[model samples]
Target: MPNPWDLPDELPTDLPVSRCELPDGRVLSAVQEAEAHTLWEEISSAAPYRKAAEGLRPGEAVIDVGAHIGLASLLFGGLAPESRVLAFEPAPKAYTCLEDNLARLLPGATAFRQALGAASGTSELTYRPYVASASTLYDDAEDDARNLEAHLDNIGADERTREVVRRTFNVSQRVTVEVTTLASVMAEHDVDRVGLLKIDVERGELDVLDGIDPACWPRIRRVLLEVHDIDGRLGRVVSRLSGLGFHATVSQWGVYVGGSVHLVLAERD
Candidate 1:
């Protein structure tokens, strides 16, 4: 399986390699290397994602609800070679690139070109994507005006601009998509034991969580998400899960502003 002709025969003593002269007529580098495919090596170590990568083991089922180009999935795959992952990315361009990258990086990983939410039926989805925040779910009304509290709840805003934007502008959409809830889809596949679940569905987080039942929260071991502020508080999201006994702690490592990326790690007692 190894081609000896491409390596040096002498292999230096001070170097970090051992050379083995083949019986027939070849030299092996004796340097072992593990193949990898990652966009940036350092980013994979930046978040709680780094800890997730370390805890990963072969065959653990993980779900990437908003897999953008499979960056996290690929990194998880590299850390746990034999694990099976399910990736869902809604944006057309991102999903396409996600599949393409997975094909070359994590060939065994499964990819879904659908958005995840609390419902199964088709609902309008605005593609904000990861790179842009303004490209969020558009209001049907071009001149739709939302109060600052409403905007902060849907998007994120402090007391600073609550009434300002409501008095000023509008939002529009160039596209819309159908979304499915995780429970419905996973139920169809009979996945009861979700080892890890990461939700970064831009602004559709509330919709996604709405689909999950309080009873099922115990089954979900981890939920790394970008939660939106419904009003001026994270209570609505927190209260819902808290009633179910999930110790929801909010943190400030961001991919989404106004609200923090909520890493609500829960375990069944």
Candidate 2:
């Protein structure tokens, strides 16, 4: 396979490219250098999905919703090398980087350039070029800004860093993208069992969960998602998962203390 991630001959020239060298000496590509570092630290160093991914069986699939630039998928592939990876990313730039990264780093992994939601159709996605990871289908500018500010305060980020982040979220472009449901994807791919379903779709986490068919719930062994607990969404998600026979646990990291963001780890009971 070609190693474009190492040499970058096939990458787009118009968009800025950022590469981070993992502790394992593997180079990953992204649109922003700082974001790339942060993703690597969270996905590889911190390893939030480690526990959920541990249950992966050989030939099972690991589904990554909101995969961004494929950092989390890369981690999953490392944690469960025998399993397959399927990543979904809606934003054009981010999806491009994700497709490239997975193609070069994870040869057989599949990348989809569509958003997963409650129903399959076309939707307007808010794409933040500066902060590509923050792009989402739910475009609540005020709430997003406030949440980011709180998160930055909780992390004690410097004023310069705060200003830069604020600016990144301030400007965004709306793009029409194809949307599909998780159940549809599973059926299409003939994925009989999902070892781990990792979701990080900004504030649209609930919608992604709602998209999963009731029949498919039994196929998902574990789910790890970042939920923005706004309007009692956290409670609803927990209840829904629990009803579906999952034991869910919620925790907050220091970086998200002042904000409503949290991590929910769910395993089949």
Q: What clash count goes with each model? A: 2, 0
Q: In model 1, which regions exceed 4 Å deviation?
A: 1-43, 128-135, 138-173, 254-269
Residue-level lDDT of model 1, residues 111-183, one tens digit each, is 8878787767665555432231222442323222222234356545654454433322232224555578787
Instruction: Give the TM-score of each candidate.
Output: 0.62, 0.91
TM-score between candidate 1 and the true structure: 0.62
The best candidate in terms of TM-score: 2
lDDT of 1 at 68: 64
lDDT of 1: 0.55
Give Cα distance to truth, residue 193, candidate 1, Å: 1.4
Model 2, span 1-269: residue lDDT tens: 75422433333324577677777787777888778887678666555577877858998999999999998998889888999999999999899889999998998999999999999999998887767898889977666866888888878889777765666556677899999999999999999999999999998898898899889988999999999888899999899889889999998777777777889999887
Listed per candidate, the RMSD to the true structure in angstroms reads 16.1, 6.8
Q: After superposition, how far is residue 211 of candidate 2 from its true place, in Å?
A: 1.4
